[model samples]
Every structure is written in C-alpha cells, then in structure tokens.
Target: MGGAFVAAALLARLGGRIGLPTIPLFILAGILLGPNTPGFVLVADPHDLEMLSALGLVLLLFYLGLEFHMDDLKQGGRRMALAGGTYLLLNVGAGLAFGFLTGWGTREALVLAGVLGISSSAIVTKILVDLGRVGSPETKPILGIIVVEDVFLAVYLAILQPLLSGTNGPGDAALKAAKALAFLLLLAAAARYGTKIIGRLFDTRDNELLVISFLGAAVLVAGVSEWFGVADAIGAFMVGLMLGSTTSAKRIMTLVHPLRDAFGAIFFFAFGLSIDPGDLPSVAGPVAIAVALTIVMNVLAGLATAKMYDFGRGPAGRVATTLLARGEFALILATMAASAGLNPRLSPFIAGYVLVLAVLGPLAAGRSDWLARVRPGEPQPELVGAGK
Candidate 1:
C-alpha cells in the first residue's frame, strides 16, 4: 500500500508537468508495478480497497453535479433529450452490427452494444472542468446529454443484472425490468425531495459537517440502489444530480473538494492496479477494434447531435471531437463484465483504451477553441452565456 501510494504520487506529479491527465499515468504505473510486470511487483488486495475506490467514484460524481445549476438542466433539456437519445441508438446499433459480425451471442451482443453506446461521463466532466470549459455553451448540452446518459446507464445496468444472473423466461425479465424502473423512479424522487431536506441541513457553514453530509447522502443512495439490485454508481450519480439542482450543491462541493481529490486519486490508482497484463496480448486486437469503433460512432453521433442543435460545423466538430473519449462508464462496464464472468479477456483492454481516451479527450477540449478558429466556413465560436 505504501509503495503504491508513492508510485502513484510520482506518476501524478510527472503527468501534471507534461499536461497529461493523471489517471492514465497512474494506470501505466500500476501496469508496470503490477503482478504482470517484471521490474517491480506491488500488489494490494482489491477486496480491501474496492470500497474506498467506490466511495471515490461517488464523490467524483457528486462534484460533477455541483458544477451545474438547475437552469442549465431546464435550458438544455431538449438538446440533451435529442443528443443523448440519438447517440445511444446509433452507437448501440453499431455495436450490435459489430457483434454479429464478430460472432458473439445475442445476449453478449446486447451487453457489448450497451457498453459501447455509453461514453464516460466521469472522464468528460473531469476534462471539461479541468479545461475550464464546463460553463461553455458547447459543454452545457454535452453535460446535459451526459446527465441523461448517466441515468440511462443505471437503467441499463438494472436490466442487465437479470440477464447475467441467469434468471430465465421472458416473464422474469419483464418483472425485473418493471422493478428496476420502479426503483429508478423512487430514486429520482428521493433526489428531488430528499436532497432538498438534506440541503437545508447544511445552512450552517461548517466545512466538516458539510463534507460528512455530502458523503452520507452518496452512501445512502448507493446503498439503496444496491439493495434494489441496481448499480451503485448509478445511485450515487442520481444523488449528485439531485443535489446539483439545489443552490447549495456548489457549497457542498467546495467543502468536500479536498476529500474528493484525495479519494479520487486513489480511485484512479486502483484503476491502474486492476489492469492484468497477461490478458492484454490475447484481447488486444478485438479491444483495439472496439475502441476505434467506439470513438468513431460516438464522434459521429456528437456531430449529428450538434448539427441538430443548429451549432455551426466548427463548433459541431468541436463537440464531436470532444465527446469521442470514454472513461468512467467503460470502467463500470468492465467491472460488470468481470462480475458476470462474461469475458475477463476484454476488460483490461477496455480499461486501457479508456485511460488512453481520458488523456486525449482533455487535450482535445483544451484545443477546441483553436480547432474552431482553424476550421474553414465555420461561424465564430459562441460563448456559453452569450445567448442566455
């Protein structure tokens, strides 16, 4: 554990100096020092650390929600609906086609398609925030779309559990689906109503109290989601989204910022540690194809969505380019795949691909303005609040 911390810290510091996201570097370091690599082997028991990593992910989503205001959601509702819906449909369709061509079974195909259809909200939001583009007009719709996607991911995971757990018959599947939907509705209500009450409790400006409250809400929601047999990350994300609509979300974020960073760092490090090098050689080809297809389909989907929103080609292109990277959702899917015993061969490849995209996406976001400027026959980039 001590060795892992020191290595992670060194990698993070080096990554910062080179303008790379720390997550990828942490992953690389883990791969190097992990059981797979020969130079230095530092393996920690994952069972001991999984809870901490999970908490970190929860805090990460909470911070993402705090960054947005209710008005952002209200204003971008239509765009989000259009963009998120279309993106999911197109990417899932593409994934199904690929799966059929690759000879995967129907069930596996659906799982694969669902995995590919989702982009990394955690990664995208973090990149946008780091780049100071979170408040930009382009980002508003993108994030709005991501918010919707996060909900969809939760629902999808709920649907997937029955399929993976070997619950037979269409009746069982339908019943599970209904139960999942009911649970989701209940969760939304809790976010809307329960968070409001929780928000009021933070009226006093005690930072420690605020942090505890914020984390407590995350755990409560995650626990409830798990009890309902839905994915914990989904529950945590919903909690954040609910708090996001409240005026005090930002204050809570501010209070928990340090904790979030520390735990979030550990989360990424754990991600690194989880990659198994032995599996890479076997899955490399398929994983590369999957990653490439994911980037292409998502980018096109983003472009199509941007055009529908009446964004000019350059801005639309920027949006498409920026949205191509995947991170958190991919990690979540990899975790699900591992749990299902579906295909351990594919998980590390997907994880590595996601880490690579995490690095690339932020750099693209950082260059979006320059890209827009350089594109011919494109309108000037519009500031996020200009029209509003």
Candidate 2:
C-alpha cells in the first residue's frame, strides 16, 4: 500500500510533464510491485481483494449515475441506441468471424463475440474525467451512448451467464431475458418515483444521512440483482442511474468521491496485482488482437453514433476517439468469463488486453482535440459555434 501510494503520487506529479496518464503509472507500479516483477510481492487473498475491488466498482458506477440525468438520456436516446446497437453488431459479427476462422466451436465463438462486443464504460468515463472533458459537448453524446450500451451489455451478460454455465437451456434463457427486462422496467419505474421519495426522506443538508441512504439503496439493488442471478454490477449501475435522476444526486456524488477514489485505486491496483507476468508474453498475440479490435470497434461505434445524431466529422471523430479507452467493465467481463469456464487461456489474454487499452485509450482521447483541430475541413459546429 505504501509503495502504491508513493508511485501514484510520483506519477501524478510527473505524469503531465511526461505526457503519460496517471492511471498507466499506477498500473505500471502494480506490475512492478506485483508477482510479475521483483520490486515487491504483495498478494492479498483474491476473494477479499475482489470484494474490495467490487466496492470500488460500485462507487464508480454510482458516480457515473450522478453525472447522468433522465433528460440527457432521453434527449440523446436515439443516437445512443443507434451507436450502441451498431457497435455491438459489428463487434459480435467480427468476433464470431474471427472465432470461426480460428476453428473455435460455435458456443465458444458466441461467448468470445459477446465478450468482445462490450467495451469498458468504467475506463472511458474515468479517462474523460481525468482529461476534464466530461462536461464537453462531445463528451455528452459519447457518455450517453455508453450509458445505453452498458444497459444492453448488462442484459446480454444476464442471458449469456446461464447458457455458458450450463445451468439453463434455451427455454431458461428466454425466461432469464424476460426477468432481465422486467428488472429494467422495475428499475425505470423506481428511478422515476423511488428516487424522489428517497430524496425527501433524506434531506440534502444531512450529508451523512444522504450518503448512507444512497449506499443502502445501491446495496439493496445489487442484492436484488444477485438474487435474480444477474451480475451485481448491473444492479449497482441501474440503481445509480435511477438515483442520478434525483435532486440529491450531486450531493450523493460529492459525499462519495473521496471514498470512491480510495477504494477505486485499490481496485485498479488489485487488477494489476492479479496479472501474472509469466503468462503475459504467451497471451500477447490474443491480447494484441483484442486491443486492435477494441480500438476499431470503439471508433466505428463513435462515428456511427455521431452520424446518427447528425454531428459533423470533427465532433464525430473526437467522440469516437474519446471512446477508445477500456477499464472496469472489461475487467468485470473477463473475470466473469473466467469464472464461467469460458477458456482458461483466454483470461490472461483478456486482462493484458484491457491493461494495454486502459493506458492507450486515454492517450488517444487526450489527443482527440489536437486531432480534431488538424483535420482538413470546416471545424465542427459544436466546437466553432460554442460561446457565440
């Protein structure tokens, strides 16, 4: 922990001068101090660390929800739907094609495609925040699309879990889908009404009470999701979204930011520690393939979303560029896949791929403005017309 803190501080202090994101530094520190390197050996019990990481992830999602509003989603829903739908289709199609060409079985191919189709919202959101672009017009649509995509990915995983686990047949898959849909509907209704009641129940001036209430709600929803055999991350995220629409969302976020940051650091550090350096080279080929596909798919999805919203080339390109980074969700998916017995060989590959992208994704997003400015054409209306 001390080493991690020192490294994080050094990176934060010097990262800007060196053109590196602070996150990559933290990751690199983890690799160096992890079992992979000789710097230090800190291996906490996996179950305990994962529980801590899970808490970090929950808080991260909660903050994401605070940034969201029903009106924003409603306004951008069409474009988000278009971008998310097309992106998933392309990713799954391409992943399936790759699997078939590689001689994988149908079920295995489907699982691979499903895993690849989803991008990491947690990573993308964090990158945007780091770059201070979260409030930018270009950022809004990208985030909106991610919000929609997250919902879809959650639903997809819910269905895929049973099938992959051999715990359910096709009929059961249908039932699971129905249950997932019902859960979404119930969540939406709760967001529309439940948040208001909760807000009234916990006065904003009572910060401790508000925080406790917010966390309690998050845990309750997460428990509900687990009870229904869905991923807890989905439940946490949905609860956040619902709470985000409330008047108290901002306060909730402010109260939780410090706790979120501390635990979130632990979460990412744990992710780094979990990686085995010995296996990295062996998995490099697959990781490379996965990273390349992530970049391509994210860009394409961004462009498609931009075009759907009638955004010009610059904004579209910027949005697409910004969406390139992968983080928490990717890890979550990989972890889930490993547990589900997808392929032992694939786990490290996916982890390595996520780590690579987590670093590169932000670099790409950070440079998006420079890229946009140098593009040959009329500047984007959103960029040029702003403050006019």
Highest TM-score model number: 1
Per-prediction TM-score: 0.84, 0.82
lDDT digits (tens) for residues 354-374 of candidate 1: 766777776766665544443
The 0-to-1 C-alpha lDDT of every candidate, in the order given, reads 0.69, 0.67
Q: List where candidate 2 sits over 4 angstroms from the true fold.
A: 1-17, 22-24, 99-115, 122-137, 175-181, 302-306, 309-313, 369-388
Please provide, for model 2 over 222-330, each residue's C-alpha lDDT reduced to its tens digit, 9 standing for 90 to 100: 7687666667767777777877766777777778888777777766776667667788898787768877876677667766766677666667656766666656666
The true-structure Cα RMSD of candidate 1 reads 4.0
Clashes of 1: 1
Residue 317 of model 1: what lDDT? 51
Off by over 4 Å in 1: 65-72, 104-107, 129-137, 194-196, 201-203, 363-388
Candidate 2 minimal-lDDT segment of 10 residues: 379-388
